[model samples]
Target: MTTVTLSGVGAAMPQPGDAPSSLEWLIYQSATAALVDAGLTRAELDGVVIAASDQVDGRAISSMLTSGPAGAYLNEEINVASSPAHALVTAYLQILSGTHERLLVSSWGKASETAGGSIQAAERLSVEPFYERDGGLSALAATALQASAHRAAAPDRARAEAAAAAVAARNHADGMTPADVLASPLVAWPLRALECPRETDAAFSIVVERSGRAGSEGISLDGAGWCTDSGRVAERDLVGLPHLARAAADAYERAGVRDAAAEVGDWQLHDYSPDAELLAYAPLGLCAPEEALELALAGAQPVNRGGGSLRGEAPFGGPLRKVVDAVSQLRAGAGVERAVAQIAGGFAGQFQTVLVIGRQA
Candidate 1:
């Protein structure tokens, strides 16, 4: 199988607002910039994978609207129709299958296009209509459930609060003061706005090519996996993300990774909420659940380097944004040689994607 390397990455981020540029325009800008970064022209890209969701985009068959802007006009193109991180794995498979030499992958989300209440409704709709939806499950409420579960499963609440607060404090998008984080209004019981990822208008792209022909400084998708679960939330252990844990375990096995936290130079987490990060600690092998405070409170990037997803973002673009940040960090200097990015979507991580990145081809 051919090796896949991350040859280039670019992003266009405007504060989430009623902006002037259309979503297509943002994609075009980011895609074009990525090609420039890769030192490749449109003609050199053999295929394209664009990620977006109709529900989020507020239109069906949204790819029909984005292909031209993404530079996939008259070329091979497919829509992951999910998180951009999933698009990366799909692009890697296309390369490994020897079906494409180079691919351009892009993803974006314009939260400003939809009303705040509407976005919340869309999130609630993600749950199963017959079961979970009727019980009232929004992303925020689901995360709150996970937070409560984590605390209940722990030996004591103080340790859980400390670890979770550490993730919130260190990764706050605007560097929100600790007092500000505490003062942030609660959207759901035990779930404050400060503990959640902010919505934004953003478009990001990356160029991936077969290793030997790709540039020397490029990072490669060493291993990855996507997982889904329907184990029924009511009976599930909300404190742990089993689907993500399984995905990480599968990716690690392929990458030959034994000690994930110790081996990785940097980590990029979806951290849908503060407790989500603490919940993922033991699963990702970052540290024991009880020891989360030790790493999280230590410093910036305790585990999530690039300030994680708390900084720049696109609502559904969390996973891909993580990858984009990792690429920037890897190319910047030495010391940080390997990284991982994790993204989950749905009620308490119904679907998950994990990617293991390394400097070597």
Candidate 2:
């Protein structure tokens, strides 16, 4: 297996209401922060990977849209439409293949401009379009249907779910109550407004290099598994996703983790929604499906301790933030002996990515 090391990581999120700047400004801000974090000058960057939806941005290509401003003029670049996590995986493989040694991976989305529906729009394009768009199925509705079924098999612990939300919200500096979650208006059946993640604007970036002290610098990417399910919801098993289970199994084997629950003391979760995180727990083996709420609430397997995307709304930034938070937990050196940083894409019977990071051997 090819091991990839993280040399430096940096992220920039536009404040909740930063006056909109031209595309160039957005790209420059992100690139500067990232290069600085990596301890390299802009001229030192050798490669760059960009992740963003130009269609959603109402632009043609990121290169054309943010050219001189993005500092792409400073290095080589490639573009993809998936999550930043997706970009990282591709970059990791490229490095392992001896294609590139130093790389900057970034994804930026301005929810302020495109609004919050981009995730669903991007998701539908990846799957059988007829099943979702022609059927008029929104992601929330799909997740709600799944949540309803999950609750039927088990039961929704309103308090536990709320507590998990509270944990994420408070840690992120937002202090919403369990009652807030319970009373929040419904977006889709069984999925209260609070149960789903809010749409916030932000950008994310990370730097990976082939040469570095693995465990000493920061959390290294030990194992990564990403897969996509049938895009058509009707074609997928609504009850559960075997692909996720398979992905987790692959990651576990790669990381040499025999018992994830016992070995992983902390988790940085992408709980974009109660059901998504709830659905995620079992596949990752953090706990049994129904047991996730209890485990999360009791702090047994504390997830989204950085408040997740729920605490703050930064679409492209969520997973990157989760990775950074996990790295912090691993580097704290006080407690939290071990940790795993996890992120997902294509939820609701679609694409998913799972990454396990920790102190490398």
Top candidate by lDDT: 1
Error of 2 at 194 (Å): 1.4
**Model 2: per-residue lDDT, tens digit, 1-361?**
5556665666566675667765456657766776676677666666777776664455766556654444556577777666667777787777788887777777665666766576667545544554446665665567777776665555555554554455444444466666677777877877677777666556666777675533225557777777777755667775577777877787778778889888887777656666566667888888786666676566545676656767665555346677767766776655665666666655464666677777654
What would the per-residue lDDT of candidate 1 be over residues 61-168, giving only the tens digit for each residue? 988998788889889999987567778889988988898889999988887778466777887787778866788787778878888887778787776666676677
Clashing pairs in 2: 200-313
Per-model RMSD to reference: 2.1, 3.2
- Whose TM-score is greatest here? 1
Candidate 2 regions exceeding 4 Å error are: 66-71, 116-132, 155-173, 213-216, 316-318, 347-349
**TM-score, per-candidate, Cα-based:** 0.93, 0.86
